[model samples]
Target chain A: MISRLRTALIYVVLGLGALVMVAPFLWMFTTSFRPVAEAFTLPPRWLPGLDSSLESYRRLLASDVPIGRFFWNSTVLATTVTLGYVATTTIAGYAFARLRFPFKNALFALLLVSLMVPIQTTLVPLFLLMRWLGLVDSQWSIIVPGLTGAFAPGMSGVFGIFLMRQFFLTLPKELFEAARVDNAGHFRTFWSIAVPLAGPQIAALSVIIFTMTWNDYFMPLIFLNSVDQMVLPVGIMSIRDPVGNSSATSEVIAAVSLSILPVLLVFLVAQRWIIDSFVRAGVKG
Target chain B: MTSIANDAAAGWFSPQNRKETIAGLLFIAPALIGFAVFVAGPMAATVVLSLMKYDLFSNPSFVGLANFEAMLDDRRLWKVLGNTAFFAVFAVAGNVGLGVVLAVLLNRNMSKTVQYAYRAAYFFPSLVGLIFVAVIWQFLFQRDIGVINYYLGLVGIEPVRWLSSARNALWSVIILDIWKNVGFAMLIATAGLQSISKDYYDAARVDGSSSLRTFWQITLPLLSPTILFLLTMNTIGAFKVFESIVVLTNGGPGDASRSLVMYIYEQGFKSFNMGYASAISLLLLTITVIVTAIQFALSKRWAFYE
Candidate 1:
């Protein structure tokens, strides 16, 4: 009887905590369906009942947000960045992991340190460089810089190479030896053998990069000046001018819901894979 | 012998292979060059610019540590730094505490499906960009029409101007930040919990230990490594807090929420005082490195990586 009581207590505490964790999102869901006036009704309407309407969604769709254009831009930009990152990081990661060359450790060290340097420090020089290349306000500026997988020699992604290298180092040397005996070159062995076997790491890296790029706002905010080029996060910012007198609460909530839902869905679908990768990597490597 | 000959013919060391190496470099060149120009080059520039005096258009003239001298004398700089430290400490502590509690709860074997759904819902806030989250919370905390006040009205509590008062604004921002990021800390901690073997719990039960006692004596001790690592990451992130402040409070009503990064952005971009801004950025970076180093040094005492 005591044990059962303890178990029930644990469940109650856990359930209450989980409710707090989920409350804001539930409030978001409730408010999105609520009319402007009804959003803050007495006693606080916590859920969407019969009176809940789709008006906010309609307003979001009908607003000057160009929600479709923003979505397209985000998709294209994220895809391009992810693909570019994969191609670059794979070769670079493999080289750092397996291949031998002069100053390899030194170069890799430089990359690691660069990863530590925050983006704010480099914004001015990067802006100037972009202006020099006449690439400011263009998609290429975002895509090209993003191609720098694991960040630059001096910031964010030096660890990318390290993570990938850890995985690569664990592969059996016998596979490489056998390939070499069969007259396969390094490149051929890498593609035919290593690449095919590296499905999990690739998936892990791709998902991480996709999520990073998807949630990125600062880079796009600084670079893309026009409405047509605005990504979802930045596009959403233009909805309510911070100084405007208009009540943009409902519209902004709809935009937030739209921006969040897709990524949340992706994360849900890939949660198992993500967790698996981390566990395997953390334990074995 | 045939394969050996082919290996020789393929010539891994041949002049042609050097060209292939160059091509490989070419394949990775875009990323490499971008990194060099944008990240490395700019960082070096920031360091150099910090030593000089420039206001955007004019060529920077080296002032030989004047920027640093100015930063030391600037009272506003110190205030912002204190605010940032306070924010980082509280926010990190709150998230870490909340994360551990949630992880412990979810670690149980029953009701796993409901737990997963709740985790997803919590993580949804983090999926949206910081600015968007700010927008939602801005309305939620508004003095008049906010749902928070609406609920408070029932309890006969007067509406509070959450973002208007100097004393309340910073705390409100911190609360928003804690809510935004607690889910992330929970995920990391939960992942750590999943890695722990069930044998630990079983052994404790065999020894006649209660569940709470088992958690305290076993689980928390074992989870120290993950907690340490996550604490370091969370502290660093909280120190760099910017967007939410920018959107919600704009470092007002009276510079209450003016964090170090916001100050850097304002000085650098808004006022175009590149030299002064670079100095502030350097100070912020120094604080980050110092704090991270201190954490690493102290982690040796408790972080239990096998």
Candidate 2:
């Protein structure tokens, strides 16, 4: 009886925790469907009724804020950066894992140490470098740095390299030796043997990099200033009237909901892989 | 003549060695070049820039530690530092504590479906961008119309000014941060808990050890390394809190919610004090490194592997 009671208690606790976690998102979803006056109603309706309208969403889509353009820019930037990161890390990881060269260890060590430096330390100089290149207001300012792996400590391509290197190290050396005996060059061996076997790691890295670049706010905020050039996060921030007279709460809520839908959908689809990757990374370390 | 002969005989310049070197270098070239330009070069320049006064419009004049000296008297710097430290402490504690509790609850003898559902629910918040988080939480904390205050009214508590008041704004941001991040900590802790051999629990049960005692003796000690990892990462992340502040309060109610990183942005971009901003950034970098080093040193006492 006591054991059964304890089990019931655990379920109750878990259920309550889940409620706390899910309620706000539920509220946001409902409010997006609500009219402006209904959204701010004193009773705080949890569900939209007959008064709920799609007008807020329509207004959000039609607003002069250029929401679609921002979305496109963010998509292109994130996809390009993810591809670039995967390519750079895979090759660098392979080199670090399999190749023998002078200063290899030293260079790897430098990369690891660079992970400790804060992004704030690099912001000013990177901005200046962008200016020097005449790319300050261009999307290239964001894309170039992102593709080149100029990321913050935990979010950097160095972490990706580390993950891939660890994965590559677990592969058998005989595979590479077989390729070399077949008169294969290093590139051929990597492309044929190593790349084919890296499916899981590539999926893991791609999802992670895509998510990181998509949700990134600081880099885009600093680099791209024009309203039309803004990414989603910055663009969302731009929608607010600075003088505080805006009564578009419902519209803003709609915008927020729409902005996160892509990532939310991606997370819903690839959540298993994402969680598995994090678990493997943590447990192995 | 002898050296030349030896060099030729050593095979250092042989085709095989040359091929290996070239391939290796080529493979790493993209990352190396990117790192040198975008990361390393900027890092070196920050050190130089911190020592000089530059305003983007003017040729930078050598200031020779004036920026660092100015930080001594800058009250805003001190305030933001205190705010950041306060945030890190509360946010890290809340995240780790709640994460452990949630992990423990899920790790218990639950159905697989139940476990996955609860995990997904908790993790959903982390998927949204910080901007959305800020916006959603802002509406929730709205004074008269918010769901939070509505519930508070039901419980006969007064509606608190969550973001408008100076005292509560920082804590509001901290709460939202904890809400968004605790799932990550929970995931790490769950992994840690799952990895422990079931034999430890079995032996403890055989020895008539109570569940609480087993948790204290077996679970926490075994999970210390994962906890340490979460601690270091969480501390670094909390120190760099910027987006939530920008989106939620914009350092409002007279700078009560401003973080160190946000302050750096204001100085560098808003005030155009690039030199001083670099100095403050270096301070942030120094603090992060020191905090991480301290965590590493302290981890030896508790974190166990094998």
Candidate 3:
């Protein structure tokens, strides 16, 4: 009888924990559908009324903030950045794992230390460099910098190198020897053998990089000059008049919804792998 | 340095080793160059800039001791530092504690679907941009029409002015910060939990130790490394909480929520006083490095790694 009661209590606690964990998201979805007047209605209307309109969507779409332009810019920038990181990280990771190199360990150590540098410290000099390049306000400013892989070259590429190296280290060394004996160059062998084996790690890194770049506000805020090039986060900043004097609730909700949905969709699609990657990275670290 | 010389000697002695050094450098070059220019270069500049008094218009005049001296005298610096410490302490404590509890509950022994569902739901906020997360929470914390106050009113409770009032705003921000990131910490904790051999739990069960006792004695010790890592990362993350605070309260209701980072932003960008801003940033950087080092040091005592 006691055991049964304990089980019931466990279920109750888990259920309540789940509710608290998910309530805010459910509230976000419901609140987005809520009419401006009803969004904050007493008793906190858990569900939007049938009359909750798409007027918020219309306002967000119609705002002078160039919402569409920002979305497009963010989408393009994030996509290219992810692709650039994935490509650079993959080829580099393969080399680190399989190829011979001088100062390899030292270079790897340097990269790891780079991760410790605070982002604020670098902002001024990077901004000055961007200004000097005549790239300030240009889309290339964010894009070019985003492409550069920071220290822990492999590891900081979301530790793509370490992960791939771990996996590589575990693989049969004979396969690479066979490829070399067959006169296949390093690139050729990597393309056929190593690349095929690296699918999961590549996917993991891509999702992580995509998420970080997409959600990044700092660089985009500093580098991108005009409304036309502002990414979603910065774009939202412009649209959001923190004073609450301008920009209605609907428009804000609409903007939030717009910014959120694409990444939300991505998360839903690869939820398991994303979770696994995070788990793996933490344990390995 | 010795290793480099050894590698060169070894490579020269063995013909096959010739290709290894070349390949290694080639492999690491892109990442090295990128890190150098983007991260390391700027960091070095920040240290230098911290010593000089420069606005954009003129040459940065050398004022080595003055800026650092001013930092010592600035009273607001202490308040902002205190505020940041409070934020890091509370947010890290709350989130890490909550995360360990949730991870324990959602261990591999739990229902698979339910675990996945909980993780997915909880991590939803983190996937979104910080600004969007803040915006969503803004409505939730609304004074008049906020979901929180509205719900409170339902229970015959007074409508709490959450973000608008200075008294509650910082804590309110802390609450939202915890909510957004607790899932991340939980995910990390979950990973650490999984790495432990199930044999340990099984052994404990055979020994007839209570589940709670086993968790305290075995699980906590096992998870300590991850806990330390999470604490360090979360502490850094909490200190860097600017964008969300900006979007949510704008350091509001006075300077109640003005974090060290936000204060630096105001000095550097808003006031355009490069030297003062650099001084504050240097202080911020010093605090970050010290705190991180302390966490790493604490790991020696508590963090049990196999």
TM-score of each: 0.89, 0.95, 0.93
Check candidate 3 and list the clashing pairs.
Answer: A100-B20, A101-B20, A101-B24, A102-B21, A111-A151, A111-A152, A112-A152, A155-A159
TM-score of chain A of 3: 0.90
Error of 1 at B62 (Å): 1.8
lDDT of 1 by residue, B119-221 (tens): 6655556555677667778877888767688878789999988988898888888888878877777777877887788898889989999777988888898
Query: Comparing candidate 1 with candidate 3, which one achieves the higher DockQ?
Result: 3
Worst lDDT window (10 residues) for model 1 chain A?
A150-159
Question: Candidate 3: deviation at residue B78, Å?
Answer: 1.5
The residue-by-residue lDDT of candidate 3 on A187-265, one tens digit each, is 7788899888878877877777777787877778777868777888888877675534433766777777877888888
Compare candidates 1 and 3 on lDDT and give the better one: 3
- Looking at candidate 3 chain B, the ten consecutive residues that score lowest on lDDT are B1-10
Using TM-score as the yardstick, the better of models 1 and 3 is: 3
Interface RMSD of each: 3.5, 3.3, 2.9
Task: Report chain A TM-scores, every model.
Answer: 0.89, 0.93, 0.90
Rank candidates, TM-score, best first.
2, 3, 1
lDDT of 2 by residue, B88-131 (tens): 99999999989987888788776877888888888777767787
